[model samples]
Target: MAWYHTYFKGLPQRAWKLNQDEEYTDYEVDFLRDVLEITPDSKVLDVLAGYGRHAVPLATDGTALTCIDISQEYCEELQTTAGRGQLPIEVVCADVLNYALPAGQFDAAYCFGNSFSFFPRTEMQQFISQIASALKPGAHAAIHTENLAESILPNFQARNWMPVQDDIIYLAENEYRAEGGYIEAEQTFISGSEKVTHHVRQHIYTLGELTYMFEQAGLLVVGTFSNLEADPFQLGDEQLYLVARKQ
Candidate 1:
C-alpha cells in the first residue's frame, strides 16, 4: 500500500458507517467559509475529503466540487452522498501526491480536519505543491488541522472503552513525541471472532513549519484562524485554519 493509504486503510470503516450524520458544528462550518471565502460557482477541490464531512455541505452552495481520497471506500461513499442529494460532484480514488490533478483547473481547494499534517515535512510540501498545481493562478485554498503546540491534550491521558455490538472498542493512550511532531496511539478491537490491534502514527506540523511549506509551494497566506469560528489564533487554539492563494 502507498504511504498515503496507510493512514486509513486499517481503520474500522464498518464503525464509521455509524457516524454518517456525525456533523460538524456550525462553528466549524462558519470558520471554513470565512477562511476559504467559499463562493458560488467556485470550482472546489476537496482533498482527502473523508466521508464527505466538509465537502457535502460546501457543495450545497452550488459550487462545482471534486472530492479525492486515498481510500476507495471513501471515494465511493462521497459519490454516493453526492448522488443522494443530486449534487454534481466528482470523486477520485488515489494518493494525493501521485494523483495527476489537472493543472490550473480548480478555482479553490481545501484539506480540512487535520489531513494536512499527516505527512512529514518533505511529504507535506509535496502535498501543498500538488494543491498549487491543481489550482488556477490566484485560486484560494484553506487547510484545517491540529496545531502541534495547542492540541496536545497532555492533561488528559487514559484509556477509554465501550461495547459496540460484538466488539469491545478501546482507545489507548496517546503519545506526543519528537518535539510534538510525531504522535502515536494504540487501538484494540476485540470481537468474538478475533482480536485486532492497530498502532497508528502521524506527523504533526507546527504553524511556523506549515507556513514555510505553503510559502515553498508558492501560496501566499491571506488568513489564519484558530478554529471554524473565525476566532483569532492564539498560542493554544487546538485547531489552525489557514487560507492562502496560489501565486
Candidate 2:
C-alpha cells in the first residue's frame, strides 16, 4: 500500500483540517466557479476529494457533485454530512486508478489539495487522460500542486517542523531524489505521549512537461495561477493552481 493510504488517519488529518479553514475553502470554491464557469445545474467531479471540503460547499448551492476518494473514513464522513443536509453529493470510496469514469458525463472536474503529486509519470498520464475523457468538450478542469520542480527546487528544505496545536508538533525530513523525479519524505507527528510517522513520496514535474501531458491527453492548458485569487503563477511560487479545458 502507498504511504498516503495510512498517512492521513491520525495527526496528519488533524493538521490538514487545521490548515485549511472554511474561509480558504470558500475562496477556492469561488475560484473554481469562475474558472470552470459552474452553474447550479452543472455536474462536477471531485477527484481525491478529501472529506468534501470543497464538494460540500459547492453542492450546497445546488450543483451536483460526484466525489471519489481512497479514504473510507473521509467518504463516510462526507456521506453523512451530505445525508444530513440532503445535498446532491455521491461519495465513492475507491482508488481513482481502478474506478471507471463515465465519458463526457461532467461539465467540470478538479483535483484539489495538492493531490496531483500523488502519482508518478505513467499513472499521472493515465489519470489526466481519464479526467479529460470524463469531461464534455469545452468543459474545464483544475489541478492544484505544490510539488512543481520550479516551486520546490528553489525552496528546498532538508528538515522542517511546525506546531499543529498546543501539543502536537509535525516534522518532515525530505530528500529530493533527482533520479526518480520525486521527494522521499519521512514525516512524524509528535503529540504529548504519542508519536506517529509515515514515509511518503511525491512526484514532481516541470510546467512545460505538464503542458505537454495535458496536450497529449486532449486537454488544453488555459491558465496557471499562483493562488485562488487568479494571480499569475511565477517560477518560484509556493503553489500552483492550473486550469485546463477539454478539447
Best by TM-score: 2
TM-score of each: 0.83, 0.98
The TM-score between candidate 1 and the true structure equals 0.83
lDDT of 2 by residue, 1-247 (tens): 8777777676778777777778888899999999999999999999999999999999999999999998878888999999999999999998889999999999999999989898889999999999999999999999999989989999899999998757789899999999999999999988888898889999999998899999999999999999888899999999999999998
Which pairs clash in the backbone of model 2? Answer: none
Which residue runs of candidate 2 sit more than 4 Å off their true CA positions? none
* Angstrom error at residue 212, model 1: 0.6
What is the C-alpha lDDT profile of model 1 across 1-247, one tens digit per residue?
Answer: 4334654543355544443334563456555666666677788899988777777877887877898888877788888889999886888888877788899999888887666656777878888998998899888998877635555553335466666644545456667776747767676665566666667666866677777888899998887787555677777677777889889
* Model 1: lDDT to the true structure: 0.73
How much is 148 displaced in model 1, in angstroms? 2.2
**What are the lDDT figures for the candidates, one per model?**
0.73, 0.92
